[model samples]
Target: MDDKKIEKRIMVPDNLDVQIDDKRITIKGPRGQISKDFSDPRFSKRISIGRSGNEISIVADSNEKKIRSLCGTIAAHARNMIGGATSGYKYKMKVFYTHFPITISVKDKEVQIRNFVGEKGARTARIIGNAEVNVGKDELEIVGVSIEDVGQTAANIEQACKITKRDRRVFQDGVYLTGKYLETGERIKG
Candidate 1:
């Protein structure tokens, strides 16, 4: 007997729209739009992504474990893209210092960390994509339609404040991600 096809589907909400073309998927909603290239050779061979009857689907030609796994991964990415287009993503980070007060600012698509742990000069983290970075006195808010962009931007900020060659117990000065939220104002974690 021939192998049965394996597939995963994501229901498209009425308010949002999805478009697939040439190994790329674009999701658009009221909040914003996000497009991702799913053109990786490994994934392209095992899975095919398309839309049918108000749903997005990833289909695997074979029931092999690897093929099914790849289909699942593609489906998850599509779901995230749709969710992000509709609700977006938010990340909150806090600045903590023991030796010196840290100053943070956003300028020219970059986050500048100044006076961090008594540093002499400013260190900068490049902001990725269209993600917005709002630097408060001791807190930061990163928001964007793409989860990857928002998360990577947050990582950049946190990494910029990383203390090296210092005792972790005493020199515990850094920016930490405290909470995450969806654009609907629902907190994911804290």
Candidate 2:
């Protein structure tokens, strides 16, 4: 029974405020705040998370591979939270249609796609968390402080326009993600 400890540390940016309570971590910045619970009954007894100075540390008591990986995973998640809090995330989507013109609109935390593939009824995608959707002439933009919410919202819009019954390559009328960007207008590789 080797019980060597494994630990990972994530540096917190000066612009962000991090708070650790129990197994939950909350990060606040100029854009918004996000809180995530890292508690898992399976690993609760083996792993511990805490913040010291300006760094977050994830410590694991067991030398098992799974526990070590969990420590790294928590560190990655914390880094993402810090980045999202400081810079935020944006996803750009473009509308494509052969004949029927597609119209997108945001109404009360829901994105409505009208006349997609000449469909009579409008298709709706739910907005997650505090993400904001802006519909233009032929494009849509989704922005949020949390990467998970922004990315998921973009995926929902893309999935809603999936063509199932149509031909393999003919009916290619749908919404697609074009680019991803940070709040500072820096492009992010998709």
Candidate 3:
């Protein structure tokens, strides 16, 4: 019988507060608070999560590759939550067009893209969670406490400007991610 155990621990920063209740984890810091539910019905019986002092632990009874991978994924998620709550995440994007001038605007929870490829109608993308989008003449900035939300928002903008039924090599007009950084101005390598 295989009796090996898999475990991973995440260290919580002093400025951040971590709370674990059942399968839900909540982290609060200077930037903001983020709550995530890690409960999966299929793995609930095989894995357990707990906290001791400033360390969060994820343990699995089975040493199988899949279970071990899941433990590591959970630990990584917790680390991202801690970092996001403390420093926040930022995504920078630039608008590129060869012919028509592209105009972008944020209204409520939607980002409006106008004059794309000279299209009369506008295309819109939905903003996820509490991400804030700043629109400039040729650039956009997305900022949020949750990494998922910020990344998704940037993707939405890029997808909204997707070129269809056009020559791929010639007409290269779209929104592209230029850089990602922490709120404190540290560049994150993609």
For candidate 2, lDDT tens digit of each residue in 1-190?
5588898999898888999997899999988898999999999988999999999999999889888889888888888788889998989999999999998888998999999888899999999999999888998989998888999999999998988977948988999999999988999875
Q: Model 2, stretches more than 4 Å misplaced?
A: none
TM-score of each candidate? 0.94, 0.95, 0.97
TM-score of 3: 0.97
User: What Cα-based lDDT does every candidate model obtain?
Assistant: 0.87, 0.90, 0.92
Tell me the alpha-carbon RMSD of every candidate.
Answer: 1.7, 1.3, 1.1
Instruction: TM-score winner between 1 and 2, please give it.
Output: 2
Judging by TM-score, tell me the better candidate of 1 and 3. Answer: 3
lDDT of 1 by residue, 1-190 (tens): 1288997989999998888996789989988989888787766776788889899888878888877777787788888788888898999999998878888988999999999888899999999998999888889999999888999999999899888898888888899999889978898653
lDDT score for candidate 1 against the true structure? 0.87
Ranking by lDDT: 3, 2, 1
- In order, how many clashes per candidate? 0, 0, 0
Q: Which prediction has the highest TM-score against the true structure?
A: 3
